[model samples]
Structure formats: C-alpha cells, structure tokens
Target: MSKTIRMLNKDDYPQYEAMETGIEFDYIAHIFDRLATGDNHLYGLFLDGRLVSVGGYSIYAGSYAMLGRLRSDLRFKGNGFSTEVVSYILNEVFKLNGIRWVGANTQEHNTSAQRVLEKVGLNPYITLHGALTKDTAALESGAEPWQPVTSLQRKKDWLNQAYIRTGDIFPYECYYPFPASAELFQDEAIKQWSFYENDDKTRFVITKYDQKKYHYLHAVYPWHDLTSQPGLWETIASDYRKLLQQTDDETYIWMDLTKEEAQTLPASHQFELPSPWILYGKEN
Candidate 1:
C-alpha cells in the first residue's frame, strides 16, 4: 500500500513519542510543547494506517520557518520515508503561510539525515562546534586565570569586536543569527571573561554558572592570532575552572566554538569530535 501524509493531532503524540530516534528523548517533549501552543505545524506519514514518520516546521519572524523534530521509525528505514516526510513538510510550510525560506540542521556525521535534507532541497551552509569539560582539572593544570569584565565599557567594546568578527567570517545571509546588541549580553545569570594579550584585548569567553548541574562557557571569540598564542586553550580551560569553582553545585563547563576558529587552535585544544553541524536552507 502507498503511504499517506496528513496533519498530526494530539492523539498522535503517543505514537510519535514511541518512534525510536536516538535523540527522541531530548526532543519529544519539546515537539509536543510547540504543538500544544499551536505555533507550529506537525505532520505524519502513515503506512498501512500506522504513523511511521513525523516532522514539523515552526514559523519564525522574517518569513523564515525552521524544520523541527524530523524522525521516522527504524523499522521503516531505507524506504525513502524521511525524504518524503521532509518534502511534505516543506511543501505544506510554503502553501499554508507566507514563509520565504525553510531551514534545518543535522549532525555533520549523520549522512542519512543529510541526504534526506538534500533531497528535500535544503543545502548545507555552516558548521558549529561544541564541547564540555567536567572537573576542570585539564584547565587548571597550566593556564592563566581568566579576567572578569566588570566594566560596562569593556563589555560593550567586546560585543562590538565580536560583531565585526562575525560579519568578517560569515558574510552570507543564512548563517546563524546573533544577538544584535551588548544589552542582550546583560543576562543576570551569566558571568563574562576577557583574556588579554600584551595589554591589548585578544579574546573573550562567557560563562553561566548553573547551580544544579554545570557551568556553561557559552562562547570563546578570539580577535588576535590563535595559533601563535601558546597556551590559549589552557588559559580558557583554567578560566572555566575558576568559574566552575564559583558554584559548588556544578562541576562542568560547556564550550561552543566555530569550525574556522577551532582549526586555528593547537592540537591540545583541538578535540576533533564530530564536525559541528550543517545548516540547511531552501527558498520558497
């Protein structure tokens, strides 16, 4: 029998939840929550009257829509189900609303998902890197303590530099959007740090001290030469260690790096994990 695609309903959540996507545990609730709010549209592909694949798109400002929680049953793999479902979702997104572009992302190493995205016409564009450090022993071994940026002027200066750096590296329109201003950085929960080289501002990192689980070093933006700067990673690790100490409740610090920037770091800092992720997009 041929497969049929249709809008998903609340009753369909249980079956959708049961689908065995390895990352489902992290996203199932998020998908349903968005569905409940009626801000997004979810659809399912039915085979033999049973839901085998599910996907959705969320509308964003600027006529942009993002594909979310695309998954199909493992038993139904290799049947082109994922590609079909994504095509259906993108078609619906363009027809039902005024969406000008649709975007999605998958782990760089997940070739199966990438192929499905490509089949649906969303091209790959950018790469992002992320890592986490627990116990801070590596950072503290041989690095300088990071300096706190208490001055509002310095914070503004760093934000400006970061904006320029972002524009310089990613001139393309579809790169991940960044917060527009320094005021956005004034999150009461996060502490910011700056590492200077020879009295000139060189690099900066932001950390949020979570009371329950771990500290998060959300970003590390460097301005000067990263490769020439010996022990830069160690300095960052050491700084993260100090941030981790501020909260007895947390033991880990997470870091987000760009692929371009990560390549400039020394091998000791380059923990070549999976290639960040590829952002895919298509115009309606």
Candidate 2:
C-alpha cells in the first residue's frame, strides 16, 4: 500500500485527535487554531484513506521555523511512517524562501520518537531537567508557599539577581537564548513567584499553566541560590501542593531544572531523572 501526504484541515482534527500521541489535545487545538489563523501550516499523512500521522511547522523570528506536534497512531508503529512524515515536512520547509533553519525538540526518554527524528537527520544538542511534584508526603510538608511577584520592580530585581549570579550563560527560555532586555518579565504566558528570605528576594520561580493537563515552571537560573538557601525547595514544594489541592482536575506541575538543580531537589519530591532534549536543526 502507498501513503499520501497532504495539507491538514479542520475535517482531519477528529481523526488526528483519536490517534495516540505525546501532544495533549489542548496543544493540538492550539495548533489547529494557528492553522486557521494562518499562523502555522499543518500536514497529514494518510494510509489507506485514513489519517495515521500529522505534523506542522511555524515560522518564528530570525528566519527559523519550528517543527511541532509530529505524532502517529500506535498501530502504525515500526513502519517508518514518522520518519517519512518528518522528511516530507523538512523538504517543504526548505522550499520556503525565508526559512533559514528548521528545528524540533523531543523528550530524552522517548527513544522511539528520537529514533524517528534521527532517521530524519535531526540530532540532540542539549539536556533539560523536567521535575514533577506529586508525592503526597512531599506536598503536605507544610513549608512556605511562594507568593506572586506582582510589582515590576520586584520582577526586575529577581531577573537582575539571576543575571548577576549565572553570568547569563544558560538559555533562560527553552532553546532560545535568554533575552538581554527586562521585557521577559512582562510575558503574559509566564507567572513569576518568589521565596524571599528576610524581605529580600532570595529565590524566584516562573511558571506557565494551561489550566488543563499540566503547569510548567521554567528552569530556574543560578539554582544554587535556591538550593543553598535553607528550606527554600520545601517552601516551594508546599506552595505546589497547595496549588494541586485547589485544582479539582488532574493537572500536573512540572519544573524544568538543570541536572545539578534536579539532583539538589529533595528526595521526597517525585521527579524524572534529568535528561537531554536534543534540538535538531538543519540549515537551508
């Protein structure tokens, strides 16, 4: 049997939604919304007249387009379908005049997905720590919770502290280099919180919640600031527990930390080992 690749439409959503993938439905919806608004281009692969896989790319600043939401049905496993779909997308990306580079990121534990990416010529480049707080005991420890940093001055102070302590070498935001401007503090997507010591902003944490599947806290910079501070992680853990308690849904909280930062987390906190999420890219 042969496979056919074509642009995906709203009609294909139900079929793609029914298929198993690491991407959550909310994100899937976000992708379709972008597609509808001309913010992204999505493509689907059909086998025997059924949509078995879907993928897409979105143009970003600096002549870059990110490949996202590449997923396939479980029944199609071992057929090299994923690699075929990715290769097709990469070819399409290169055809665009303004796109200079194409890239994607995958969890380190997802070896199967990584294999597909590798087969399509994307390689791993960096490791990021993903930590979760779910253990009942850890959450119930009664430590102090982080308060939201509402004032711009306080937010600026926290960022300045991070910059000074870390020397601005690490990527503060996912794969993109940390912004040199203070405007990062104003992003609506992220909410900033802090654990202060004696009215001084000793520690800070930034997080984004979808109010659905999960809440992701950005990777903390100068993690040593928090780890070295006595009982700070516990305080953060307590706050996390309180957040979980208030939510009736099963939304999980994830914190991205460096390998060293992850290791410093209290053993009571349940989390995955620090692993590298490779950013694979190709120049056009």
Best candidate, lDDT: 2
TM-score per candidate: 0.63, 0.60
lDDT score for residue 179 of model 2: 25
Question: What TM-score would candidate 2 get against the native?
Answer: 0.60
Q: Candidate 1 on 1-284: residue-level lDDT in tens?
A: 96799988777877777777666255555547557347677888999788898888766544667786777788888889888889888888888555666778688888888888988888875666654455433323354545566776666566567763453322111223322333234433223334333224566644433321344543354444544444555565665667666755645444545677666655555243455766787767
Local accuracy of candidate 2 as per-residue lDDT tens digits, 257-278 = 5566666666765666556565
Deviation in Å, model 1, residue 116 alpha carbon: 1.3
Best by TM-score: 1
Candidate 1: global Cα-lDDT? 0.61
